[model samples]
Structure formats: C-alpha cells, structure tokens
Target: MVRSTNSAVRQDAAPAVSERQQSRVAKRAAAAKPAVKSEPIELPQDIDSSTAFQLIAASIFRQVGANEGAVRSANPQGVHQMRIGLRRMRAAISVFAQLVDDPETTRLKQELRWLTGRLGPARDLHLLALRLRRARGAAPERQKRLQVVETMRNEALATAIAALATDRYRKLQTDVWAWIEAGDWLGGAARRQVPRRARDFADAVLAKRARKIARRARELEALDVEGRHQLRIAAKKLYYAMGFFESLYDGRKSRERMADYQRKVKELLDHLGALNDLAVQQQLTGSLTPVVRQSDGLAVIAPSRHERTKTERLLKSAGRAGRELADAKSFWD
Candidate 1:
C-alpha cells in the first residue's frame, strides 16, 4: 500500500482544511524517486482521491504546530497530543501509501518514529513522577526519593528537547509537505486507472479493517501481554484510518454515527494505553530506583497487587469496546 490514500484531486473549492493541506506541498521536490504502489483504489468521477489525501494528512500534521509549545513547556498533555498527531500521520501515510511513495516518505516516517520515541520516554517518566509525588506521604526520606525520580525525569525531558531542536525534525516536516503537495501522483500509471469513489473505498477498506478488529476482540480475554499489545496497536491503526476517511461518508447522521464509533475506539485505546503505561512505570521504576530507600527503607510506590484488579477491569472495558466497533456498520455505507 503506497500509504493508503492513493488517488488524485482538483483544488476547486477552497476550504480552510484544503489550505492547510496545500501548505505541506513541498516546493523542493528535487529528491523524489520513480513510481511507487499506493492504496490504488479506483477513484469515482465525483470524488478526488488526491484532495482527500491532502485534507487527511493536513489535519493530522496541523496539530503538531499547536502541540510544540505544550511539549516545550514540559506539559504532559502537549507531549501526548504531539504523539497522537504523529501516530495519525503515520497511519495516514499507510492508508494512502500508493499515491505518495517516495524515499522521503520513508525517511519522514522514520523521523516521526525517532521523534516520538524521544517524547514517549519523557512523557512516561513525567507521568510516573507526578503519580509518585501525589501519593500521601509526609516522611522526609520519601520526599528525597521523589526528588531523585524528578531529577531522572528532567534528564529525560532534556534529551527530548534536543531531539526536537535537531535539523532532522525540520527536514521531516518539509519532506512531508513535499510529499503531500507533489503532483507526481497525478502523472502516475495510477492516474490512468478509474479509481473507486472515495466513499466506496472507505466502505471497503473500513469493513475489512473492522473484521480484523473483531477477530482480535474474540480472543482478547485469552491474550497475554504481547497479544494484548498487538491488539491495542491494531485498534489504533484502524482508528486513524477511519478518521481520515470519515469525510467520505455523506449525511450528518452518517458522520455522527462514525463519530460515535470513533469515540468507542478511542475509549478502548485509552484503556489499553493506561494499562501499558502502568506496565512501563512498574518496570521502569523497579529498575531505576531502589525498592527500598537505602537511607530510610522507604519503599517505591509502584502499582500494587490491588492495581491488578484495576488493570483487569480496564481490559474488560477495552474488549467490550472493541467488540462494539467490530459489530458496527461501515459509516460509508
């Protein structure tokens, strides 16, 4: 799949989203390679695939700009939001792979991974630190241990800042713009094919993807740590794909129905995300700090046996949500 939104579009009516979408069309197109495979879905006479790709990619990319300040300020929400934006863009590229398959596209995706990795650790540590700090404890020795965790978090954030300031990050953004606006897709052999209408493409692809979710959901209760991890990842990928294609669906009711489905998907993702974070923090703090403070024997505030019950509850919720999504109708229908 040339990251899946693989078709063409004309810039007739100017919407704010279109303007933003067009903004990333890179002026420096000196580095693109020859024909790549993309989603290659047949475009209907009424729907332009290229325009749809632009809008989808642009919406995902735009959030990065607003999120920068928040990440810089060490706000966990900022880092979290930026990570979401990057993940969505990656999925968009996957969803529209055929239409925009350049070496630069690969490079940009790698950079996104690198950048998100940097942000991920700092965000995780920040969250863990905050949780540790808020636990009711008045002992001076406990305060000192908290301070050590805080120091570790600050060091991680510094590393993230360095990654953000690098030239590669800027270059990735530039490359993404170039890929989005590059008219190379219009001139490809793909342009010769009568692609399916955007609506039809959405319906087909979404239904196929939903079936995967349903299959995964069937064994959610039986999944081990790694199995559950894979399920969470699949859910996220489907979530991003649905978001980009939602615009292809007609009628206010259809849009609302999709929106409702998206929310359910998100709820599952959040529960899984929280569970993952709890796992990470437990592993991280266990390795990074002394279980018992050397000076006063103050123990770490890691997730307790009691927390296992909470994790189980979250898993149940996620499974239910995933099943609901799997059974839901394709919004494009």
Candidate 2:
C-alpha cells in the first residue's frame, strides 16, 4: 500500500509493450550497429553451492590478474577493461553470495573493496592522461599548451603506478586468490528448505536484494552522496541477482522493471564516479603545478570540469528515480 510520488501515473500506466516487441527493437538496433559477442555461458541445471561459487570466484580472480597487470604496465585501456571485469565479478558475488555462504566471503569482499580503492586514483589518472593524449594528437600546436598538463599527468600516473606496486596491494590480491582456493566456503552450515527448492531460493535471493535496494533508496532520498553511491552498489547487485536466476523468474514485465532499475543505478553511480575522478584529477593538478597555478592550465581541462557538474545533476535525477522504483509495491512483491 506504499504510495509512490507518481502514483497516478503508475496506476494508470499503459499496457506494457510485449517482451517480444522489446527483443525485436533490440535486434534491429544491434543489426544497425554490430556488437561484440562472447560465447554463451550455460548455467548448470543442478549445482552444488560450492561449485557454483567457485565458478564465479574463478572469473573474479582472472579479472584481478588482468587489472593488476594493467596497473603494472600503466596501460589505460587495460585498467579500464579490468575495472569492468571487476564490476562483473562483484555483481556475480552479490547474485550468488547465498550459494557461496562462507565466513570468508565477507572478508574477501572487503579485500576487493580495498583493491578498488587503491586502483581508483591510478585508473582516473590513466583515463585523463589518455583523453588528453588523444586530444593532443588532433592538433600538434596544442602541445605547447599541454606540456604542463603532460607533466601533471605523468606525476599522477607515476604515483598511481607506485601505489599499485606496493606490498599491501600485492597482499590484497593474494588474499583474494587464497579465498577463492580456500574450498571451505560453507563451513558445513546446513541449509533448511522451503517446499519449493529452486523457487524458494529465487524468492529469498530476490527478497534480500529488494530489502537492500529499499534501504539504499531511503539513504539516497536523504541526499547523502555517499549513501546514494552505496545504494547504487546495492542496486547493481540486485540487478545481477535477478539476471542470474533469469530462467527461474522469467516474467516479461518483471524483467523489464529490473532492467529499468539497473539503468537508473548506473546513472547514479556515474555521478559519484565523476566526482571521484575529479578528486584524483585535482590531486594530480596540485602536484604537477606546485609553483604557479596558471589560468590556461585549468582552462585546458575545463571540459572534464563541466563533466563533473553534469554528473552531479545525474546523481540527483537518479536519486529521484530510485525513490520511485523503491516505493513500487510490485518491485518488492
């Protein structure tokens, strides 16, 4: 009986376009723009929780290796790619954490967080440096104006790279891998069952994600920037949890709602992501231009500054959207 702010609009909502129609539209778009394809992954019909967990953990471990390699080589593209891999792996954990229930999963997730924090500054600098380098390529004369920018970029990149190489970062990665190979995830905790096994599992998992999303939505509504970011993280997990059990919860309209929530979550996350980038950039700028703060130097990087503003607006918009989604009774039921 929760009333949405846009209750009237939602109550009188038009009949949804069929899922078939949705698929056709996507098909047409893909045909117009060819897309990348990885081999289809098939989830097993009957899986022991431990094996299922290992599969996901293995994927994450591979991503860590890849990202760590990029951090070492200072490859911007590699770092970006690895961040994506880490995201997917993180999503996988949220989706299947119950299956992989362990004393260590919490510990491992914390470790992953630390790794993300360590790499964040470096990744931002790498992205900024790459963007500037690409722009510099378009106009040769621009180099004179960019020398200070380049020096700043180099200093930031070096600091990030050095941080990545530290013993702490290395140990963090090691601990993650060790957790994966630990093989004692469940600690032999026995699971009781509801009459419907798969269905019950699906319901429980979805319910857990819903509760998290609701908590996050409330935080966001309170205008807590950090809280909003935290909520986005929860929403991403919820999005992927529904996806992992797609076959079990194959309702067309419900799937659409999940996708909608995912989009909103990403939109919000992008805002915080931009702010984080600016923080790193500001640090780099301060370090590289210690002597004289030139107006031109700041002007040259004005576009990134504008993007920061744009992302802040998106965060607010996304917060409203999240509140709407969270208040929907159907979203929880």
Candidate 3:
C-alpha cells in the first residue's frame, strides 16, 4: 500500500479548530465591543528578530479575530478594523520576508490576500455611502444612490461573513498561528538570521523603506494617479514597519524622536489617504446613473464645483505632506 501525498500534507498541517469551539469564540467576539484603535505592541529592546516578529504577528491575528463577530453583524468599524489588521499583517510579513522565505509563508500570504480581497468591497462601499450622506444636499436622487450603495454593501458584507465561516478560513487561521509559532522558516538556513538583534534589523528595514519614500516624494506633484497610489502604499508600509519597532526605542529622547518620525509619516499617509478617497469616490460616483435634467436631457453627474475645489486643495496638501516627510529626520538614525 502506497501513502498518498495528500494524506502526508494533511498529517503535517495544523489541527483545524472545531466548529463548536469556533461558535463559542464567535459568541465571545460578538459580545465584546470592537477596539477603537490598534494598541501598540511593546517588544523588548534586546529581543531577537524572530521573537519580535512573532509578537507582532500575534497582535495582528488577535485583532483580526476580535473583529469577526462585528463583521458578521455588518458593523462598519469592524470591517475597517479587520481590513487594516490584514493589511498590517501582510506588511509585517514583508518586513520579515527574508527570514521567512519558505513555501509555507508564500502559501499563507496567498490565503491572506484572498481573505483581504473578500473584505475590500464592503469597506469601500461603506466609506462611499458615508461620504454621500455627509454631502451638502439631501436630494431624493442622492438618497436613492445611497440606498443602492447600502444594498451593495450589505451583499458584500454577507460574502465576507460567508468567507469567515469557510473551512479554508479556519485552516488559514490555524496554519497562520502554527507558522508564527514554529514554521519551517524557523529552521534551516533562515534560523541563523532569525536570532539577529531586532534593533539592527529595524534600522536596516526602516532606512531602506524611508529611502524609497523619499525618492518618490521628490517628484510628488509630478506623479500621476497611479504613481501617487503607489506612493501611498509605500508610505503605508513604512508606517506599519515603524510601528513594529516603536518599543525598541524606549529612552525619553529616542521615544520623542520616534514619535515625531511616526507623526510625519502618519501626516503623509493621511494626505495620501484623502487623495485616494477622492479617486475612489469619483470611481463610485461614475458607476451610478446620473440624475438627468428633463429640459436639456443632459447628464448631471459631473463632480460639483465644490468637489473640484476640494480635490485641488487635497492635491496641494498631499504635496506638502510628502515634502515634509522627505525632510524629516529618520528616528532610527
């Protein structure tokens, strides 16, 4: 009798969480209120890279799990938190990519990307609906559009909920936890690098990512939509990277410098985020049928003059923020 490869893989995989246990966890999550913000992870200054990575990954996993019940209930903030958690987890993986370059890590990343994709639409639609509600006018047409957005958001949320309940998701969670604890990356050639001091690792990663952002910032105004979007992503990754090492800089002076660095990066991210939101709003608005005028039969869907002005203002603000970030001193220095 020959053993099957599938059976071999199954034997090696982490034990799946039972459905009954999952139900109890879900109930606990549902009863708890979602955290308003991500709490900072505090790692010791002398911790090894592998240990630091594990702590960061564990914090992110907990965040993702904490929001599941709220997501099932269609809570907008829950959706946002869960999405951010996933994004941060992906960034963390990238930061530690060199030490975790195993096949299992790649497979886990693919699964995470799939889960993030499932949750994206709902978050985007929810933001769009909020924007529409906050607009100056309360026209019936606007209300109708808002209703359509809500319907789409509900559907998206339903899909996200279904995704959370899937066996694939359960296995993904189990495997991720297993990987964080004792993945293959911890053994073999990578083991040598994993034990390196996190501060040294932090300094190298921060300086490298910062350089990329600085290079992009130099021509901020000249960047087109796609370029700006890429800049936003780089800034976001750098921000998450910074958070991972915040606890390593614990001295009063170091803390202050780190705080300033974080503030500058965050400012840049905020401006870029606003710009992205404007683009997304434009895309969402364009997808809807415009309110038509009876007399001239013209489409009334173009962005309002106010919106055009806001866009111009946001562009200027984003450019300024980018420049400021470029000039700011690196805390890791």
Candidate 4:
C-alpha cells in the first residue's frame, strides 16, 4: 500500500494506555461471555451485499493504515495494534465474503498477504531485539557487547524501514486505496444477482481450495524432506484460506476439526518464520559488522559469539519444525 499523505491523521491519536488501564480491560474481557460487540451505527437489514462489503472494506483499509503507521513510527504498541488490525481485517473479509460474490475478494486477500509478508520480517526482528535487550543488563560484559549488537540491529532495522517507505510500497498502498475508494471489491456480479442463500457463498469459498489442499496433505505424507517442505507451503496457503472463511461455518464438529487444522498450519508457519528471521539477522549482522567498524561508518556491529550461537539455534529449531510439518502423520489431522 502507498503511504498516506496524512500519515498523522491515519493513526489514532489516543494517548498510550497505562498498565492499569490494560489490566482493567483484560479483566473486563475475561469476565464477559463470548459476544460480538455491536457497531455504534446499525447497518440496515435490507442493505445490499455490495454496500455492506464496501463498509467492511473501508474499515479494512483504515486498519491497514493504522498498522502501517505503527510500523513507520517504530511504536511497539502500534505494531501490536497493526497485527490485530490485520487479523480483524482477515476475519471481516472471511465473514463478509459470504454475502458478496466476487473474485476480487480473493485478489484483495492476495494483496493483504503481500502487505503482511513485507511487515512480518521487520516485526520479528524488532521483537527478538526487544527480548534480547531485556536480558542484556544481567550480564555486564555481555551487556556491553549486546549493546553493540543492538546498535547494529538498529541499523539493519533502518534499512528495512527505508525499504518499506520506498515508492514500491507507496504504489501498492495507493492502488489498494484506489480500489477501496472506488469499491472495486464489488466486481463482475451485480448486487442484485447475489442470492440470499448464505450456504451458496460458503460452498463457493470452502470449495475454493479444499479439494486441492486435502490431496496435497495426503501427498505430503509420502514426500521426501524437500518435497515435504514444498507440501507445507501448500498446506499453509490452504490453512489461511480456511482461516479466512472459518467464521461462516459453525457446525460444531467441523469447526473443531478446522480449528485443529488451522493450529497445525500456524505451528508450521511460525517455524518457517523463525528460520527466516534467524537467517536475516545473521546476514544483516554480518554485513553491518564490517561497515560499522570501518573508519567512516556508524560504530554498531558488535554481536557476541553467544548471540551468533543463538541465531544458529533459531535456524536449527526452524528446520526441525519445517521437517515435522512435512512429515507429520495426518498433516490434516
């Protein structure tokens, strides 16, 4: 997505919540029964599918902007907020796609996937760096070295930021904005052509990738190590597809089974993600070390031998998870 001109206005201006407020909110949420919060403004019962979808799409865009702002501003809470926004946007798309019959929904999903993928590495690195920083004070000599490592990490982060802020990201963002503004999500089929049978929508969506994934899951069981890795990618795409539409199906047994499948895919994805992160950090840290120690550059590259070891372990752990995802009995089960 292109960066908005009103970046400041794009973000919510609310002050940061204190720990006390967070505790209270958590308590309230935990004490409540599961319920969907009603929107402040009620949507008309007779509203057209296209209209309803446009409203949801607008919300999705706004949320995406907020997340992007979080990333650009280097705010941790903003980052969390952005991740939540992405999840909610995904959920909303999955739920409402039932009402509106459009292939563009799939296209938008692909766009979301792209946007989220770009942010994923940056978020992971930031989280890992924060974790490492918290542990640094306990080891004095190590602390000094870790601080050096952190300086290099910051430089690497800046590079990621520069990439995100470039024209490419902006162009994508602008294209998405144009779509939302013009309601391109309501493509091809007219609103009047859509039937009232929600089941039809669910069927269309469920059938989207269900058969292929099931076959792939079976194939995954018989593949060699590399083949299994390939299979896991298919599994993840299908899992995300399922996750997108899980809200529409409430059949007790099926829902439970789908949830299980989603969890398995998520586990595997997390593993792949960790492996990716470690590789990035290792490559980045290695590159920055020479640059930072040079006579004319920022003096930051100071990763300790131990920190490098941690990166290796992270990579190894990811490899194991990838293998498990590929080799597990009943990749679907």
Candidate 5:
C-alpha cells in the first residue's frame, strides 16, 4: 500500500465552500451564442455494437455543441458539462479503438485531449476554491479567502475561453463529426472484424469487467491502495458500458432487471468513487494547506486529527462494496 503523505488533518484544514457559492462560480463566466454549427445527434432505441459506438460519440459531440454557448458565457456548469462530454467521447473512442484506428480518429482524440487540458485548470481551481471553503466550525478570520479563489478562477477561465476561440477548437468540431459519420471503419475489413451485435459485445465486455471487479473485490483484503484504485476504474468502465447498452434490454422484466443492476452498480461505484477521492486528497491535502492558509492572511482550518481512522473506515466500506458487486448477478446476459 503506497501511503499518502498528506494526512486527513491537512484535508480538514481546507475551508468549506457552500453549494450556492459553487453554483455562482459556474454562473459568472459570461455567455454568448454557440460557435459550433453542428446539429444535435440523437441515439436510436436499438443499436448494434458499431452503431452504439457511433451514437454515443455523436451524442457526446452534440453535448459539446449545446454547451458551447453557456461555456462561452463562462458558465461553470457549461464547462463542467462540456468536460463530461469530452470524457465520454474519449471513453467511447477507447472502447472502440480497434474499429476506429485511422489517422483521423487519432487526431480528433488528440485535439479533444488538448481542449480537456485547457479546461482542466479552470475546473481544478474552481473545485479547489469551493472545496477549500471553510465549514461552519472555524473562526471567520481563519477561513480560506473566497475573493482570492474567485480571482484565480477568473484567470483560469480566461485561458479556457482563449483556447476555445482558437481555429483548432473550431476545426475539431467539424473534423470529428465527419469522422463519426463516414469513418472507413464503417465498411470493409474493419466491419468484418468488428461484429454488429451490440448484445453480444455488451455481454462479453461487461462480463469481463465484472469478473475483474469480482476478482479484485475478493482479494481486497490483501491489495494495496493503488491496486484498489484499478478496481474503481474497472467499476466505472462497467457502469458506463451498462449505460450505453441499456436500451437493448427491451421487455418489462428486462428493464426491471436492468434497474436493479443499475442501482447495485451505482452503489458500488459510489463507494469506489469515495475511495478514489480520499486517495487523491491524501497526496494533495498537506501540500495545498500552506497556500490556502496564507492567501492575504486568511487562516486555513487545522488538519483533521482523525484522518487515519477515517481512511481505515473508508477502506473497509470499499471492501464490502467490492464484495457486493462481485456477488451481484450479470445484467448484460
């Protein structure tokens, strides 16, 4: 187990940001009309494997377009939504990598990566500011400086907006759409290799993912933190895969079966998410304390004295959740 040097005490020292404040940050980035010309793409009810990939990619692409207006306005939610759209697009591209291995798909993925990078600083700073907001317990004088946090957010937003205005960003929209609509992968040898059966593909992919999660869960008693993080990633991938193939579950019984599967998967995923958040904060908590504490004499909160205890509890919960997921029935079959 690779232990994080940043203790829970350090994490506790970060001030609490209110939900209202976070919402305001998202709203402050001024908006204008969407710059992209792409129309919204809708996914059909039933789909084959390749069609499913194309539909997901297209829908996410449409999300980027729809959010562009608010994003241009500098809405934080717009940035968040567009960022999600990028993430989902990237996931689809990865899942379907064998099918879409041409130069164009590679280039588009790279461009999306670039945009994601550009958006990351603003998003991270926004989160830091919100997350570092002091909870009710601390003295008002010791709270993290909301003003300074907002200033940093503005600066990061400027960079994001500038990147969005570039010719490359504009071209990425058109190019990626063209690739999705008429990729060489749609026909010939590629099509022959990649089957059109969404149901079969979903079963194989999800079953493999579930097996990994099950294997990891059963062995959690012996694994380290990094080893468990891999489990969380697997869970997330399986969750996303389930979402993509959900429409294929056609009957009332099938849909009910899917609903139960979704609920169980969500529970497992949430627990996994909690573990990942703690692990990330463990590395970041102590390093961030000084900067958050010193900005214009604002005092940061004290690190939680009980951090070690909390970590132990969280790990235990993750273990239980992992076991539960491993034991759950297959939704894909």
Candidate 6:
C-alpha cells in the first residue's frame, strides 16, 4: 500500500476543529467563493516522463479545485469545466500508466471515477434542460415536461454537491496530491525508467493511440453503437494526449503539423459528440416517462422525426473526420 507523505505530515498538526466541523466549514467556503479560471499548462522542453506526469496531474487537480465553488453554486460552465478537468486527469493517468503503476494509482483512479460518476448525471441533465429551454414555442405539455427535467437536473446537481462536500472527496484530493508528489511509483524499481525523455515517451503513446483510432476508423461503417462509442473515447484520449505534449513539439513545421492533427481530431470528436448527445437526449427524455405519463398520458418523450436523418448525417461526417484523422501526419513523428 502506498502512503501519502502529506497525510503523515498532517498527522503531527494539532487539530483546531473536529473533522466534521471542518468539512462543513470547507463546504460553506467553497459555496460562497467565486470560481477561479484554469490556467494553461505549459511543459518544459527538457522534462522527464515522471516530472511531466507530475506537472500534468497537478495542473488538472488544481483546475478541478478551482471550479469547485462554481459547481457548488450550480454554475453550468463550472460543472462543464470541472468535468473536463476530471477527464483530462484520467487521460493523463492512462497515458502515464506504465510509469505510475502502483496500488495507490489504482485506488486514486477509482476515487476519481466515483467523483466523475457523481457529476455525470448532473451535467447530462443540465445540458438536456438547457436544450429544452431553448425550444421556442413549445407546447404547454412540453413546457411542463421541461419543468420536470429542470427539477431532475437540480436534484442531480444537489447530489453532486453533496458528494463534493464529503470527507471522501477531501481525502481523495489529499491522497492524489500526495501521490503526485511522492508516490511509491517514484521509489520502486520502475523508477529506473522514469527519467526517460518525455518526448520519446509521448511519441510512443501518441503512435499507439493513433493506431487504435485508425483501426477503428477502417471499420467505422461496420461499428455498432457501443463500438463507435469506444472509438469516440479512444479519439478523445488521443486528443487529450496530443494537447498534453503540444508544447514539446514547438518548431514552426511541428506547430503546423500539430495544429492540423488537432483540427482533425477535434472535428472527429465534434461529430461523434453530437451523435452521442442525440442518443443521450433520447435516454434522458425517456427517463421522464413516469412523470410524463402521469401528467400528460404520453408514452415517452418522443424524438423529432428528423432525428434519424440527423444521426445519419452525423455518422457520415464522423466517418469523413475519422478518415482525415487516420491520414494526417503525426506531429510527434
């Protein structure tokens, strides 16, 4: 088991307030404070794999923290940004998994997953509610359904806030910060490889992710919903990985290649994400079934007739974007 050096240091400090009281105070403070915007992460050119991993992990952790206040207050952008931070952190861990494979790393990943799960429903519902609100000239029944969706979104947000205010969340933050600074991974036999140049590690990681995306692209038409979803995830990871290492490849030619590669990935993600939103919208609106039936005698929230056509269009666009990504020259090369 990996221990947190920070936890050990805190053990020697005198406690002024009970842990429960401190938690309440912290929650109040977070809710009352304004959220800080996340700053860009700039990596040093001479960074080693371990140092680069620590920098990336720590920056994302801070970004998540900076949005906690806004999330507590139910700010939509804050929730979106905080969720993005969590995803980026997850991608960072995955990218550096070989260097940081330890018991604590596994535990940390689990904790992060739990927090992300808590925030997921809130974000999803919030987006759905926003879209519904923007539907001008909606029927009276549709408006009522929108009210119910907003209520569900609020409930989800409350749950997410409660999760963030828990001791578990506090402990997770402390443990992750400590692990990033001084985890068992830093002292084990695997540490021998930690000093390798980040550029070389990044090249291998990017190539591996790109290959997966390319293979998936070849079968884009044949892929089922789940397969396409997995491909989207792979593409997202590659996108995040590319962003993390962007500063490393900084010459004019390198910058152009990176920009082009990033544009292709972003294009692919946009189309896939739109398709995902349609699917999620259906599921979310379907979840309002009981309420809808009780209030309006409707079977379920019906999708627009054009939804199929829209999905087909998105699929074609995603296929085109995927082909472009597969054919793009790797900036890391």
Among these predictions, the greatest lDDT belongs to: 6
Task: Give per-residue CA lDDT, model 4, range 1-333, as digits (tens).
Answer: 111212211122123434554444334334432212212222343444455445555655565565554455444444445554555556556655544435655766676665554444434445555655775457554354455445433333333344457787677567666665564545553644454444344355455545554455444434444454555455555554454344555567666766665666677567545544444555444443443456344454455687678756754654555454344333121
Q: Per-residue lDDT of 202-320 in model 1, one digit per residue for the tens?
A: 67667777788788876676778788788888788888787666556657888788888888788878877877877776765664555346645676666667678888888898778
Cα deviation in Å at residue 228, candidate 2? 2.6
- What is the C-alpha lDDT profile of model 2 across 1-333, one tens digit per residue? 111212222222223434554344334323332212112223364544455556556655575565554445545445555555566667776666555556677776776665554444435544555555766255543453356444433343344355567787678677667766664654542462322244456567778778777666655646554565566566667655555554443467866766665566565556545544554455444443432344443332334555567656766766676676666554323
Comparison by TM-score, 2 against 5, better one = 5
**TM-scores, all models, native as reference:** 0.76, 0.60, 0.85, 0.51, 0.77, 0.87
Task: Please rank every candidate by lDDT, starting with the best.
Answer: 6, 3, 5, 1, 2, 4
Top candidate on TM-score is 6
TM-score of 1: 0.76
- Count the clashes in each prediction: 26, 0, 0, 5, 15, 0
Model 5 superposed RMSD (Cα):
6.5
Q: Which segments of model 5 are wrong by more than 4 Å?
A: 1-27, 30-46, 138-141, 144-146, 188-192, 279-303, 306-309
lDDT (0 to 1) per candidate: 0.64, 0.53, 0.77, 0.49, 0.65, 0.78
lDDT of 4 at 54: 59
Q: Which ten residues in a row have the lowest lDDT in candidate 5?
A: 4-13
Model 6 TM-score, 2 decimals = 0.87
Query: Cα lDDT for residue 133, model 4?
Result: 72
RMSD of each: 12.8, 14.6, 9.5, 10.7, 6.5, 8.5
Determine which window of 10 residues in candidate 6 has minimal summed lDDT: 1-10
Show model 3 residue runs off by greater than 4 Å: 1-36, 189-195, 290-300
Clashing residue pairs in candidate 4 are 1-172, 1-173, 2-170, 2-173, 2-174
